[model samples]
Target: MGVYCSKKEVVEAQSSSFIYQRNRTTSLEEQIKARCPNSSANFEDENSHSTKHSSEGKMKCTKVCFICHERVRLDHSCTNQMVKDLEKHMDKDQLMDILMKIKQQVSKDEQSLVPYLHWGTNVALIFNPFTQGLQRTELARNIPEFSRTILARENRIFCIGGQDSSTMKSLPTIFEVDIEEHYRIKDKMNMNQARFHHTAVYDQKYDFIFVIGGMTSNSMGNQFKMLSSCEFYRVQQNEWSIMPNLKVARDTCAACLFDSQWVYVFGGRVQFEKRQLTNVIERAFFSRIDVSQWEEITLQGRQRIMPEFNVGMCHQVNDTELVIFGGKDTYNKQTREVLYFDTSSFSLIHRKSQAQSRKSSNVDEQLSQAKTLQKNYSTAQITVKDFRMPLEIEAPTSPFQIANNLFVLGWSKETNGIHLLRLSLINLNWKEELDFTSYLASDVD
Candidate 1:
């Protein structure tokens, strides 16, 4: 265990539970003094102490991570400090050089390979495969589980808390899975604010995953009223803390990253004094400076005069652009519409979706591509995947069909099936199903 200090002890005006171990024999206090130099250092500065590495190819690396403030050698982690460099000062060419150099280093390293199992007929259904890691699920085998929503960081996938078969709330616990391992949940993580339709966003700049407002009343585990409050999890720190609540108590707001400085969250349902809820985009902001808290954005990003019909389940494509898809519009799930927003232009793009094709056929070549991607280019090719036109599939539908828009998912009551579904996006398509290349159920929380 490490001793605690006020936020002052660490830079960024935040106190962290971890301290660097300089010398095996040295105490924590001395180690801090040695590495941090003067106690009054600007811990948040990116260039506090940097290095230029001349590799065997003699290419110099200008980017560096000052271990004194935030440690970078632990894993393939980029702290808030590192993100600052790329976002603010690093030129495009320099960024490419650095990325290429780093990629080379990574490709040279050796790591274990995770095997995938065929748990079900489709990727959506929970792979009940036996495990070699953390062994447990929210409910017994009688209930079905699927990767309903995944908030992916650099290499980690936070399977946002989902529903189970019974009236009971989903395990109320979120699962953190690594993409390298068929996306196995690292450990069981609980959300104080019981969430269903809420959105979890990974802000690489902030190094935090912000979990925003969602509907809670109908959720079985949510004994509390519906929540408009917000919470955040610091990825590097592996901890969750509550921030300021959203302006409205809502479940199913559309959340998008805005200007890379704030999360533009809006348009969901809010409950009344009588437990009655109305659809409204609870406009608000969640920033890295104080991500745990939220502030309202009053610029009226809502396209709806009445928020009820406004879309929810949004795929926050970027800091400035978000794709709004299907959600409860007055009565049932809206499947006919697709909306896009450009925060820079403050323009909304709406289009009618066509009934797209499913996976055309189980081509051996396609399966080979999946295997090759897992082996050689999983990390190198970090592709953008939003709701896309349905992937063509000739396979028979087994309790599920591809979605027309950003198919925000919900858990099924049955245990044995109904896991995966396809969706239609702008020009391209990609499967949002579980990674069979490297996952197992026991490897989950």
Candidate 2:
């Protein structure tokens, strides 16, 4: 008659057999290697000569361990003693309770919105709130090209025409990057004109990418030319078509689409028979088939001073609202001026408060200029406020919007490195996201 054994005894026996068999297999492998010193079997991982061995003396596959295959169980005596020791030393309620706490300690990282900065043709800096509870951190990833105007839609990033940083020559090539896949499809389509420092806006309703005023190189690629010509790419058709040109030729300007019907361009260095920073604003109507002529509009506010090239502006939380801030003024000095443009009040002039009107002695003179400008054209109201930015940030470039936050990339004199700054739309406060001083030091080393 056969005698039955307890579950613990059965587990212990299975574990012992597995250990003995594993040791014996290793010993046989060492013997085979000793015989063939220069053969491929001398290597560690490959099973180059294992297939030739008889099944009886075949080595155990290291990948097929006890944890993976349930055939080999844990030794009951050893595991039981470990549990007893842990309980006695720590005085825990239960082993599972401790494990659950550990698992809950570190939350899994779920990045809903990712903002990317072009570091170079081979690397990119990504802003994320990491798993370790850092509010916002910069992660460097080796990736594709450098682009001046980049527009994001869903999980894809479109890199439009821009001058090559290495050669400083304009490029017509377009690159589409799938951030999730960590890959880029280059030369998606070439633009009609090679340009850089341009403004691009993606129209989601019609799937068109509108490329606006930008700077291009001359025939010799030695001198720069400001462009007033505009064009757009039909994403669905994979083709480019010319659009109406801007009245004011400028580069490094701000452009935003309002109500999916109107495109507004404003605030940049302009050359209208003379080289000077411009406060001129222009708007045009864009449709599925055709775009109207660009018409100048008057921004109703105090005597406005335009920011230098590379002004940072973003469509605020409200679709009709825009926030423009952080650019060098006409004096070539960085300014903290922030303009809140409300397009919902289009064509309707906002009268100043009685107190403000009383305070301003030249209210009638300002009203007369506004009336003359608004007679035959549309008008938009803007309120200017001075907001403080960190001292290190200088030369802020065109900003892009992701949800309610606007991120600007600029140079930092204090740290002597690149700084990514984030401005909150709700509170209108700025904070430094990440500084690349340490990374720059390592590169120098």
> RMSD to native for every prediction?
16.5, 22.7
User: Among these predicted structures, which one has the highest TM-score?
Assistant: 2
For residues 383-416, what per-residue lDDT tens digits would candidate 1 score against the true structure? 2222232221111111111111223332222322
Question: What's the lDDT for candidate 2?
Answer: 0.52
TM-score of 2: 0.57
Candidate 1 Cα outliers beyond 4 Å, as residue runs: 1-148, 163-167, 170-172, 179-185, 215-224, 271-279, 282-287, 292-311, 316-320, 345-445
Best by lDDT: 2
Q: 1-445, model 2: which lDDT tens digit per residue?
A: 0011122222333333334453454432232223332223332222232222233222211111222232111111332344346547653234334544443331111112334444453444444432212122222322222245354445345667776665667778776655655444545778998887677776766778888887887766678888898998887677899988888888767776766688888766665235467777788998899889999876555534333434445443343556555555566555545555666643322223322445666645554444343221111221111135664344323455543356676665456577767775423447677664444323311
State in Å the error of residue 45, model 1: 44
The runs of at least 3 residues in candidate 2 whose Cα sits more than 4 Å from the true structure, single-residue gaps closed, are 1-112, 117-121, 129-146, 165-167, 271-275, 301-310, 344-386, 391-398, 412-416, 436-445
- C-alpha lDDT score of every prediction, in listed order: 0.40, 0.52
What RMSD value applies to candidate 1? 16.5
**Residue 408: error of model 1 in Å?**
7.7
